[model samples]
Target: MTTQGQRDPQPAGRRPDGRSERARRATRTLPAKALGWCVVVAVVAGGGWVVSRPHPGDWIPGLGPSSADATKTPPVVGNPLPPTDTDPEALTADRYFPAQRTIEMGGYKGKRNGARQGQDCAETLRARDVDPLHDTGCQGYVTVSFSGIDHPALLSSVTVLRFADDASAAKAAQALRAQENAAAALAFILPDTTAAPAPTAGAQQPRVEAVGHYLTVTASRLTETHSASPTAGASSPGVTAGASTAGQSAEQQIEAATRAVSYAAGAQFIWT
Candidate 1:
């Protein structure tokens, strides 16, 4: 199959055309390159592992929270709340009673006798009145007096005791009502007389009401020295349900007015 002059068709690593197959190295190059590549991969993987883990903050002087600090409970996150006994200026008299010299409420025009606002509970009310809420978070006290513009003889008063919350006021109100048929009322702050006259109430009892965190004690009476008398004249519809004022005496008229004033006082506390 061979001719003497023509060499064998292929040499050890040559193609049939007599070109050397590929240049060969004295050492095994592929294995050495694979070993170098494996070494490089190992180094990169080791470096990445070291960088991925978190280092203790103690490793640096002032970098982040220490391990001990991180484990500790964080301080409360929201704003601090005020104490229950702190005064809320919202309960002041000028805002609640009337801004003007005179005000109309519940179809009755009234002239403000005066308002005693932000007075200490001890100062405005007697000891017995204040005792119910002394330890119960009574933070505000106000008393306002109003005389009828048309009927000067008629007078009305609203005494509001503001507590921290509805529960406190309700508790205090219950305590107050438990003692007497009507909550005791503060003396009128007369426009002219610093020396208040004696309680003018005859048959008309004060109204005690609690709305939210406020307690209002309302009363009405004749400004003049008068007591319950027999009806002087005849007939007209009265404000009280099923009760006709047609033959009502002066005392009975004032008692009806007390109901109106108490209702008006309740409205004042709706928003405040």
Candidate 2:
């Protein structure tokens, strides 16, 4: 029994008077809800941290340039050399000849063995045990003749055997040079047998030079001579006498012409 002003005491773990069952249940769930909120916040923060870090080969939006992009080299431009092809027309005669001269042979022929109707240049190459031009992986064959300036009666001929690659051209050039040297040596003993010029006391020998896939043979029969100055006033009755402008000797002139032609040939056929 309790008096009107005194409160009645309940059992342990029970709320005071006037507390509802619903209020007690809500208070019990409040702590659990707070713990769930804390767990959700931790998970969200960890996920955000992982997303903010850098990745391989990735560029951040509106940030500094990427390492991969900065290290790359810029592209080059344009073809620096002339084109190569298997067509005989690919070897332009004007590219190697001087401006004053014209093509005397192989100007219209479009094959490796176009020197003559029956005598193919490729067959001639084969007779010497050199694989025919086409069979040796060459692009084509071209030969031309030009009138010499030093000696009007002499003509300079160039035989260009064009290959598809440098190694083939180099091998062919080496073999051809050896053949030419051997023929030259034999010409002294058997002058009428070999077509090569005999190595006299002062005679210009043939030259072989490689330019890219093209191997060139510079050959001519022009006689070389040194310059000679005449008497100051040695004027002839019919001929007008003046100072000679032929600065270089005949041999020097021939060599200069060969070098010029070789350089032109190289420049005309180099691959980019």
Best by lDDT: 1
Best by TM-score: 1
Q: Per-residue lDDT for 141-180 in model 1, tens only? A: 7777776665655677777777778898888777767754
Task: Give the distance in Å from residue 164's predicted Cα in candidate 1 to where it truly belongs.
Answer: 0.4
- Taking all chains together, each candidate's TM-score versus the true structure is 0.53, 0.41
lDDT of 2: 0.46
Question: What digit string (tens of lDDT, one per residue) describes model 2 on residues 1-272?
Answer: 98898877765656666566777899899999999999999999998777766542346833434777545312211111234444344344333332323322211111110121111335224244434243456554445444333233233445566666789989877765565443232111111112334545555665678877777765544433233223223434433222222544445555655555454445556762
Runs with alpha carbons beyond 4 Å of true place in candidate 2: 1-89, 92-120, 123-135, 149-151, 180-202, 223-247
- Looking at model 1, how many pairs of residues clash? 2
RMSD of each: 22.5, 21.6
* lDDT, residue 138, model 1: 73
Candidate 1: 10-residue stretch with minimal lDDT: 73-82
